[model samples]
Target: MSSFLKVLFRNVLNGPSTDPFPLGETFTPDRLRGKVLIDPELCMGCGTCKEVCTAGAIDLSELADGSGFRITVWQNSCCLCASCRHYCPTGAASLIPDWHAAHPEEDKYVRIEQQTVKYEPCSNCGTLMRPIPAKLARKLYASSPELDPEQLRHLCPACRRLRDALKGRPFPVAAAKVPAEAQA
Candidate 1:
């Protein structure tokens, strides 16, 4: 009893071993994993994030109207491994340091992070296509001043390929298929 009293007195004088988290600032370290986020504008609907997710927490689906794609991240299923963020081609997947993921068991299924990325019609061919974001387009075509990135942004894949292959050449039989507006 005397020894116990001595230990108790020492501990009391030393102060609380654990922080009062609810009433005070919690210890959040740098590089802490918290909420998974997807930037709709930056994301190109590539399945790289879903493919790299270690926990199988990410899902990609086409919208019902076929206008866009949807990405879903199950917060509860994510193991906070951050593989998605690391492997994302566009740097669209990220984690914010707002670790408020805890919730009652009943809410587990509803805890999800979702975003939609829409498609635009190709200006040349009138086909639906994902537009190359201006930033990425500029990076890809920066060295080629002859190729206008903004103009090519409106072309479908086939038209863009044709334009690139026939940049300095005359209009061949195949090139005749491109309309006057698309040719210019």
Candidate 2:
């Protein structure tokens, strides 16, 4: 009987404990995983965000130029895993506190946009590579065209190297015998 009275008094004193969420501002701590914001300018079209995202929320599409890429964020699929944010080399992906990303329709959950960039071919090989793929490189070439080779050349440095490496190799070779220890 005493415990019941104490409980009743406590409840009366405390008043309503239910939060009026959505109507009132809720206190959120710092670094709270909320909405993910991708800075297209800083993205390198490397698909690193898509690769690291555990929830498979990010998708990258090749641009029409074949030299650039676009990013699409599926807000519905995002689990706030923060893998994309941690592995982003350019610091392009960030967590913002805007949790009101919910939409009335399912189609409104997807956000897609193409990153703006001035694509330039490699100076030594003519292969197209984002000049400022890295944050430091972006800072350096933020405003100016730093390299040469305006025309799209078939041979790039990496491709040329690969071609040379495969030049002397046989077209096809018989499979080598597997060692006893290596057998599955």
Candidate 3:
């Protein structure tokens, strides 16, 4: 009886070992993974984040009309691994560890981040396939010496292949003329 009372007194004096969360301010530790942020201006909608996301937190979809693309990241589904940030080619995805979100038992916790970008069609086939981010386009143009920005850069893979194949072919008349000229 004496020991029980002493223990109770000690607990009262020392207070609770656990933090008073929800009722009191939640303490966020260092390197807290809070939320994922995607900069619409910087993001190219390349689907790199979507490919790298192991938790399936990031989603990329094209608009039904084929005019643009929509990129979405679900906060609740995210594991806070930051793989999307690392794999992002444009450096658009980032983690903002500012504040810890308050989660309630009854309600669904969700913070959906969405961004949209317009699609650039293929030059020859007019296929709306590539999402040419301005920064990526500029970088490619600057680095590739053989890439002609004005004429060749915009062609799709199929069109470029066809053009190359045609360039390599010799006309039947030219081959025949070569033999006749040699005989003469």
Kindly list the per-residue Cα lDDT of model 3 for residues 20-128, writing each as its tens digit. 7767876776677788998876787768889889899888988899897889898878898999888988889988876666668554544678888776676655655
Q: Against the true structure, what is each candidate's TM-score?
A: 0.78, 0.58, 0.56
Off by over 4 Å in 3: 1-32, 103-110, 122-125, 145-184
Can you write out model 1's per-residue Cα lDDT over 105-166, one digit (the tens) per residue?
A: 89978999999888998775666778888878888889989877887777777767776688
| Lowest summed lDDT window (length 10), candidate 2 | 171-180
Off by over 4 Å in 2: 1-15, 106-128, 133-135, 138-184
- RMSD (Cα, Å) for all candidates, in order, is 5.0, 12.6, 10.9
Pairs in steric clash, model 1? none
Overall local distance difference test of candidate 1: 0.83
Best by TM-score: 1
Runs of candidate 1 with Cα error greater than 4 angstroms are 1-17, 168-184
Clashing pairs for model 2 are: none
